[model samples]
Target: MTVSALTRPGERDRLIVKLAELDWVFILALCLIAGAGGLMLFSIAGSSWTPWAINHVSRFLICLLMLIGLAMIDVRVWFALAYPIYGVGLLLLVAVELVGDTRLGAQRWLSIGGFSFQPSEIMKLGIVLALARLYHGVSAEKARLSWWLLVPALMIFLPVLLVAHQPDLGTAMLILMTGAAIVVLAGLSWKIIGAAVAAFLAIVPPFVMFVMHDYQRQRVLTFLDPESDPSGSGYHILQSMIALGSGGLLGKGYGLGSQSQLNFLPEKQTDFIFATLAEEFGFVGCVSVLILYAAVIFMALRTAYLSHSHFGRLAAAGTTATFTLYVLINGAMVMGLAPVVGVPMPMLSYGGTVMLTVMIGFGLVQSVRVHRYAEVTSGKGSFV
Candidate 1:
């Protein structure tokens, strides 16, 4: 069918048309990355599907179905519910603060009906959707330089402060970067961006020395000099570096990585899974996985570019930014280039919450592609 036919009144609304519009290539990329993750998990778990391997594969399948279901929903429904979703996420964050579970010394999880989850995960998507919705009705000039920017600023910081108080600095930083990306995409002035960067640089030292919790501050110090205490606070980074360096050009061979098999690499199935891949499959495997990630990012951004509605564009782009940050931060941490922030490699790491969050973001991206031609109104009564 031609572009004109796809845009006709009832044509795009057809379920078959929407499914056909879905980016199968992008979907294939996601499947490949998740499969690589499952492969790594299986290898690291003594080739058994009983532990992390099966759960990782099963979760991806479930999240993939959820992604497709969410993709079929109208983008306008997403726009209308944006604020409500964000509102609920914020309230949950507050609830977490008041009576959240304190596991591993972080009060970031909330339990309901015997199921526990980190509310911060919800904010990951909430902030993106809410900010995109806010920017949708505003003009470029106002978005660039105006007193009107305060609304978006508040929308971002309120959650950042709340999450930071939970002491989950990794997620707080992700939320902050994702929100900043949307603001810049919305045309915030360069002058403001530059000033903000300068201020952040100035604030970091003081924040580390005074504001950061002791463990958080120690992670930064350890990243700088992992050799200082190889078996102490720096064990995670030092062991990760060893795994990466030992991997060499090819690898030690599957199920033969000493670092992970000996239980030397910390969080081998979660945060440092990349290092496990590096050890077992070496540089070649790592590069192949990185290529897959790059493809996903490129295709997602292309969807944003193809979107006609401002909400669709910003929503897709903002979600892509969050995913990109996850990959970069996790990659750096694994290689000992950045502080260990516990940011998991999306889809590649065996974590249910992060995997679910990332796939849902992609679902939004696919929805944008499927409804790229649908008209979305601004503000009240917005619809297709």
Candidate 2:
């Protein structure tokens, strides 16, 4: 159907029209990536779907349904709930700091009634929605260089500090970058951007040397030189590099990757799964998966660009930024180009939390596309 057809009175509000408006192509790309992940998990498990493969596929199916359901909701609803969602995520982060569980030496997860989740995951979406809502009201001139920028800055840093205090630096970085992406998209000044970049550069050395935990510092050091400790702190990166290199041009024909099958590669089902793919499928397979990722990114950014409302644009763009960061950080870490910050390749990695979080973000992106023509009220008034 054409755009003119949907402009008819009460036409766009129908469920059938909304469903038709959904981005089926975008969904197909996601399915391809998730399917590849399941294949690799099956391969690594000796061709059994018992452990990693089944769970990965099942969780993805559930999340895909959730994404479709969320897509049906009007973007105005998302705009209305933005602040409340952000406020709740902030409180949960505070709660995690006080009474959260410490897993693997990090105080990141909160358990309630035998259920546990990382509140930082909520902040991933919260920060995007919240910042988008804030910028939707501000004038471009004010957003560029005025002192009023501090408000958005505070909105961002508050969660960053809290999540960083949890010492889940990976999630914290993701949240920080996502928020920054929205601010830049909203027209922040180049001078300010340059200064902030310089400031970050100035602060990194001290932050690594003094603020980062011992293991965190060591990961950075290891990335700089993985061969220094092949059997210790650097083992994960070294093994990942070996797996990536041994895959050659066409790979070892699947399930025959010595690095992963022999248990040389670490975190095979989670953060290092990309290396597992590299080892079994080779460079060709890796590039194929990456093309799927590139398609998803392109479509998502196009949705943001096509949005009529500022909220829709920023929210969709911010979510895309988060997804892009996940792929880049995990890919770089697997290639030994960056520290192992425990960021998994979204949808492809074997973790429920990150998968759910990513799916939810895409849901919002789809919501934007479905309601791209809907008029969002100015932030000074009610959302409707």
Candidate 3:
């Protein structure tokens, strides 16, 4: 046999081994979550998804392609584009303030060819990249100083404030949490964290009263006392609680949920999806779903820990934290522990743009995982 032919089978075998080693758990978790979401969405949309379902399915397929494509790219490329992408995100946020569509009182969407997308979604990933890049190159000694580390804090808060000004309290709060988690993981001192906490507590009252809308304030109050407006602001929560409790220990069975099939639960497939799921699947099902999410986050964080590059590590950690916030906040809102925030549950909520963006993030984390063995020492990496 010729040398080329002799080596061909060996190379092919190695390639197959590598492909086989690629993490299937993450992909399976995503599929399960999406599957649950699709089932609920189909029911909520009244079993006929001729047009809208096609759009969602198209988005999922496109995102699946992007996930595979992104997984093959080097994390360095995303690191390179971090700044430019953040710049674009800022421009889009500004555009939203100026010429964007005003929907339901807030101008958070950009209308293009009759389709609108929330720029805040893009901002989440962009800010994560930007902050990850910023925090990647720092020495442990440098990270210990509060004054020296405040720059990345600014990078985090600036966009958060912009999001807040759009009155998207949900997105802004998530952004702040994401950025703060990055900073914490980057090895900032606890002293600095304590100071920030103190400052937040001091300033929250004025911010809530002066900056928050009446509706927003009422939501907070309603959370404090849902009984106060059981027929009004608290109606959603009251119904959600009833639906969840009605499921008892073993759920009412799929398609048999009274709250959902009877149209008693509002936004059953969107912000309050957990309610529907809990009603149909019960506590055991809810716990199992939570375990899947926990596993996904655990794997993502493990990838970050194993990564050999700072940018890849920070990026992975940031992606995991952001996703965790999405799941936690949305679940909390559905359970009535939090005020009804418009944030969608990760992978399990109705929305094409967010689903695609989130999966793209997972793809990036996978990219980071695959390259974790390679020692990438330089901070400068391509964004391709």
Candidate 4:
């Protein structure tokens, strides 16, 4: 009682209370994965990364600060800003189409001064927030048979179609899945999900063969049999598989893999980071990485369930599924089980934009968990 009585009540108390309410288990898990990512990036970058590492470390610091700031904000702030944020994001996408940076045959980034950003990443955040707003008042009767579902779909679809126009299939698919997960979590029926899946499967074959770019179609066909063109279309997959299998049981140890050292594995620090982990740490390491991902996803789903408000719940769920898809696509691509779609491994990938956006998403979910019941007085309803 004496110790409790000595404490003062203020912002510090509010901060402490919020911290106490958070899911530390999930936070710790994410931190562990992030730390591992930094270490792996060091190895991948090697002697050529002195400046790159410093800049990336600075980016990580910035990401951490943004996370803290976001986590302390009320959940309703995101809802209030959702539509405007989405509108701004769409405008940026349009700007991207009109006057954007074209690199490696994709017009996905916009450069300002010395810095560049991908509008697709911003759109990912926008779609999640926007969809959460739409699903906030969903009920079984309304959710099952209402135009509300279409509203969210259209919100998501516009950006996805634009990203696909950028010819960035990976991001477009990720955004689509993120929106679909929100719809499903909003209590859309299995009948709907199943039918949607069936329609997608039926439609994809024709699009792949006729509409997709030549190299993109090659990626899909090569995944089915990587050895078919070891010198051409399948080179990346074959090399990655060899590197992964070469690691054997424990691993070849860090910074010692011939595949990466000899420059056989492409995009070693970015899209193919998991392969770097595999080639250095082997099966045990891969399992450890998978376990960390599973833990984060599990806690994220739990956070969604425990959230006090529908908006918070949907945001948490959609964000969790987005993370899951990021990990799955990257892992499968590295293992030669899926086509090379340029999906970056969460936390581990070397891109600053992807890293920052992912961390912000994490912070947003954490904020939702911590401040789920906080009162909103800025033109939105308050819990108090």
Clashing pairs in 1: none
Query: Which candidate, 1 or 2, has the higher lDDT?
Result: 1
- Per-model TM values vs. the true structure: 0.96, 0.96, 0.91, 0.92
Please report the TM-score between candidate 2 and the true structure.
Answer: 0.96
Give candidate 1's error at residue 49 in angstroms.
Answer: 0.9
**Model 4, stretches more than 4 Å misplaced?**
1-9, 47-53, 375-384
Tens digit per residue, CA lDDT, model 2, 183-285:
9999999999999999999999999999999989999999898889989998999889999999998999889999888888889999999999998889999
lDDT of each: 0.94, 0.93, 0.83, 0.84
- For model 1, the superposed segments whose C-alpha errors exceed 4 Å read 1-13
Determine the backbone clash count of candidate 3. Answer: 2
Query: lDDT value for candidate 2?
Result: 0.93
Model 3 spans with C-alpha error above 4 angstroms: 1-21, 45-58, 113-115, 377-379, 382-384
Candidate 3 TM-score to native: 0.91
Q: Whose TM-score is higher: candidate 1's or candidate 3's?
A: 1
Ranking by lDDT: 1, 2, 4, 3
Q: Report the lDDT tens digits of candidate 4 across residue range 1-384.
A: 566555757656888888787777877787788777777777766744554455566677788778777888888878788878889999999999999999999899998898889989998888998888776755777776566667777888999999999989999999999998888888887877898999999999999999888889999999998889999989988889988999888889988877887789988878877888888999999899999999999988888887878888888888888999999998889998889999999877777888888888988888988876754442343444
lDDT of 1 by residue, 1-384 (tens): 889987987875687778989999999999999999999999899888869999999999999999999999888888988999899999999999999999888899999999999989999999999999999999989999998888998999999999999998999999999999999999999999999999999999999999999999999999999889899999999999999999998899999999999999999999999999999889998999999999999999999999999999999999999999999999999988899999999999999999999999999999999999888889563664
Residue pairs in steric clash, candidate 2? none
362: Cα error in model 4, Å = 0.8
Clashes of 2: 0
Evaluate residue 146 in candidate 4 and report its C-alpha lDDT on the 0 to 100 scale.
69
